[model samples]
Target: MNPDQFQKNSMYIETPEDGGKNFDDDGRAKRTGTWVTASAHIITAVIGSGVLSLAWAIAQMGWVAGPAVLFAFSFITYFTSTLLADCYRSPDPVHGKRNYTYSDVVRSVLGGRRFQLCGLAQYINLVGVTIGYTITASISMVAVKRSNCFHKHGHHDKCYTSNNPFMILFACIQIVLSQIPNFHKLSWLSIVAAIMSFAYSSIGLGLSIAKVAGGSGEHVRTTLTGVEVGVDVTGSEKVWRTFQAIGDIAFAYAFSNVLIEIQDTLKSGPPENKVMKRASLIGILTTTLFYVLCGLLGYAAFGNDAPGNFLTGFGFYEPFWLIDFANVCIAVHLVGAYQVFCQPIFGFVENWSKERWSNSQFVSGEHAVNLPLCGTYHVNFFRVVWRTTYVIITALIAMMFPFFNDFLGLIGSLSFWPLTVYFPIEMYIKQSKMQRFSFTWTWLKILSWACLIVSIISAAGSIQGLALDLKRYQPFKPQQ
Candidate 1:
């Protein structure tokens, strides 16, 4: 239990002598953070609009299987996150290179070649996440607007598209918000996001239960992907739905991209890992409960016909005030969540631009460079232009691929294996130096391989389904 007693083989706090690349000039990993703050960060990162898909996700896997998969993913992600934290410190903690980003961690453990892949995966995940957020925000706006209109003009009398204007408005908000400096400045935003997450999540649970108990909503059994339960027993449709369900679970728990970033935000010290592990435990446990309750209650409330977005299943008039509030909360939360996920991307792009164009006339980006690493900061033209473009592009992608649940599955299947599963498992095995065929080592290897297999299958299923949906739904050119 002693904090001084080294844990995770190599994970430790850095000292001045280490002279590692990841630290600041002041030799501090982070100026202000605690386990509570880290928990909030993880909550905001892991539990986003993905929660909206839970009922539909469960609809694919069935009552018992869905919740079980959710539980399993939570446990697995938590454990792998711990493995990742352990790699934060090398055997000689202070002398080891500080891993501030997940890419940094991969590079430190696997070398430069693999680091590029990690960097790609990490950035792709972040962009995918930002696009996901934009889609969710637009959808939330559309839902709220429709709900209001329905209340005013009777149900089914009016309908509204998740139009281009709304999507652009959401992106404009992101374009402004995404420029909010760095993680240090986002504590308040993250806290709000975390609170908003819980607010909507709990409200969702309550509404689901009330709806079910009050005998409202479509309550027929269905296959995992919302097909009528008894109608289709054997087909690729069923198989694809099951994989999509798995991918949804992965997406919900996928925070490995920012795991080290969150950890680095903690105060630098030997007990950093202990605190991080605790923070991880807190985050995992909290999200696990939310996912289970929300998903289960959502499915129970609207069995066969649950909307991919659970709240969309609710008729506009039934719970006007609460639904509007929840949607607003969800939208606002995503505005910050978009920035949180985009941080890594910003840093990556900014650093690249600074280096690639360090001599270019237009790239006079000195505001962030000259300032002392602290709270308030200013950004230059290069920073503004690149980041704005990035946000715009991602928002456009969201509009193009607006199928929320399927997009979540594709992103999850695409990035989770590389960022969360393969790297963490490989890094853990290397750091632990466990015997190759020993029981623990063998099982871990098997688990790692299983994740790869799962990702491959999930990718095939998701891509096929997404391709079909994109063709059929044609959410193209942004509906106006």
Candidate 2:
């Protein structure tokens, strides 16, 4: 079924017209401009705050290697998107729902719960990744402000003036603003976010290119030799290989769940009405080029010791106006992207409530042990409590794991294997009703095996990275 029809059919009793299709709402299905759906996904996924560190990661692969990885990622991303579109075109007929849930998709493939196990694995993986992203973004913002904007040196007079306050404040703001749940309301924000993201990316690229053209070799040496640089991988070929692994990383960037949510955004029109293919292609190509530029520019600018937080490290000389512009862009960008990740969790909770409980029981609090409330029936009370608690939990998780860029890459490495690599092929086999594996299927099996192996290696590397970060950890410390 098309997106507009899905929205109309899939809504709940309370918010029937809202069409909680995992993504945004579609108020102007046939009448709205083409930019509505096309720009939303790009703004939400491609313009994430993670791009701030693209340069540093790319630099580890060297000047030439970094952009090459971006290109590879773009190609892989394009191919994967097509695969997803294909899957959508020929959905399993048995599953009446137009969209595929992780568990449902698995059930379609592996007969019973084997695929469900995979979906369960994905649940934990996505939760961790989402939490990690929130935390990492918080931390990066902190580092960016702390790098210079705060007190120049130790001063007794500086009270609530640290980066921590700003982080908390901004995160809280995001949580509150993100709570507003209407896609039609958010589309304008997405458009604005896209504009800001493109602008930030453009300026970031220009700066990188300008630095490259300045012809200062010694500065490169400084970047290479800097002891505290986050991207230091000068002599380590293994690290370079890790950098070369951006192809798979780029595929991870596709972030399928986000698309699943916004499925309703894709409206149908008359046969004469052209598909929004142009808008979609534009968004993809723009995002791909931006990644390429950022990767290349970052490596050239920072070399070995480049900061993991690219927005802060090389942004020392960013024009004031541009900085202000990027801040607004990033703020909206965060809102757009944050909703994509959060919507599934919300849907999960919402669906569970609907299936497992009657409206009267929920209103009357049939199970009060886990529930809390302030009024008669108190269902809404506990629902508020539930959402509030999640917000707090997500915030705390963010606080605990603040290494934004590194943690994101680690999550991508560890989880990408199972979720994107293994699950899709498995589902295609069982759900698509192909009795035997074809040549393409054989290649997919090989790819899955490779991904499985890489998942292992990357997990080890990630753990090591974590261990290094926690070197000072101890159950107890001797009294000073």
Candidate 3:
């Protein structure tokens, strides 16, 4: 019947009073996460490879508009994230039932009819995210390898350019990392991933500032060609550019797909609203600062000449070590980010399997594996096979669809509105039992409706842009 109220055993009924702890003493959570750990995962979820595109985004929007959009979205993201966090609560922890997955939250609030819609959106988001990450890792490895070759050869000689091999190699790394068992177990890896994100991002930002100061930027760049500061563009071009910039920031800031599950990893706490609100503030504020630096400096460094990805704009042996380090960090961060986003995907898949095969490796506390005294969660068969294969499939897509921007455009276009804008607003209103057509409800509805319409328009443009680019670039052809 009600999945949130699904009884794991006869004695365990989750309610608002019990704080969602089904067992009296969960050794798993005891050893798991603090608010710091939760913040680390949120950082991993919030700041990914997308920040690398901010300069290119700012280039499209101009200094004023770009940073304004980023700041606005950051505030909106924090607000919506808190709304999602509120949904994680119940009347009592054990008696009322808390939502662990976005789908579960939707199913509980809206009904089973709307649950699958949430599932479709989430599944697409994760699969697209995994593909996007694989592509990024492959490209980052290629960049790292090229920098190494430049250092060795003392010139800009072309090195190994095919990304498929690197994609496969990176898939091996994901294979190992994705098996960390469950969400809370990933807290450590998420911390490392967040560190690596700052590592590469800071390097990129520092490099951009240096280039801009050094006056190394060419007058004419690929994305910024024929464009100047202060929005001196035509009507159609402005609309197109604004939508493009919106897609970039929206996609870059997107963490809604993983927000609920990330909260699930929090140490059973004094209501997740406070903890998650704190974590969201930390993660989004830090990420916004980084985005502003990267976007603004990147535009300054190579005004009208900035590349779509900031790290790739450096040519030849110039600043070889720093560029190489940035690429390495990109690869490292992607490995962890992949698993962070994929956890809910894995959970969604395995839940069905666990239900179907109750006699198999479906683990409970009593039947848990004897892995360690410290941990309550078990290592099981389904975890090993399914997760490994999922990474492998994503790797294949990376190889096949090698265009980085196109896949990202598609992801941003498709999932941004549903995941980021619409669902949270609707869910909050319904869950809070707010009055219809009241001032707050009316304003939120308008905002969400505006978001949906813009998202649809942007998605259409992105699809067309991606299709035309694929037709023109045909990246799948073996690289020279």
Taken over the whole model, the C-alpha lDDT of each candidate is 0.76, 0.52, 0.73
Global fold similarity of model 3 (TM-score) = 0.80
Candidate 1 residue-wise lDDT, 1-480, digit = tens = 111111332344567565655555345553467899889778767777778888888887787688888888888888889888888766433446566666667766777677778767777777788888888787777778888888888876746554566789988887887666656475888788878987887788889889878875444564444454347435767788889878877888787877887887777654567778899999999989989989988988877566888876673767787898988998889887778778767766665666677787567544644446655567777777888999889877876778778788888888878878788888888777778899988898888888888888877777777787777773433221
Model 1, residue 397: distance off in Å is 1.6
Worst 10 residues of 3 by lDDT: 1-10
Superposed Cα deviation of residue 198, candidate 3 (Å): 1.1
| lDDT score, candidate 3, position 406 | 54
Better of 1 and 2 by lDDT: 1
Question: Number of clashes in model 1?
Answer: 4
The TM-score, computed over Cα atoms with residue i paired to residue i, of candidate 2 is 0.72
How do all models score by TM-score?
A: 0.85, 0.72, 0.80
Candidate 1 regions exceeding 4 Å error are 1-26, 29-41, 92-98, 179-186, 217-219, 222-234, 265-270, 365-379, 474-480
Best by lDDT: 1
Comparison by TM-score, 1 against 3, better one: 1
lDDT by residue for model 3 over 1-480, one digit each (tens)?
124323343235344355635432332223245678778777766777888777877877776777888898888788888877877755333334666667767777776656777778878887898898888888888887777777788665646467888888988988877776655565777678888988888888888878877775456342433255354556665566567667777788777877887787776556567788898888888778878888888888866555667787773457788798888888988887787678767775766666767677343212355556666645676777888999889888777677665567668767877887778887888878899999999999998888777677767656655665566664433221
On the 0 to 100 scale, the lDDT of residue 23 in model 1 is: 58
Residues 17-113, candidate 2: write the lDDT tens digits: 6565433232232323344565556554665555766766665555565566566555544444434433432354322334433343345335456
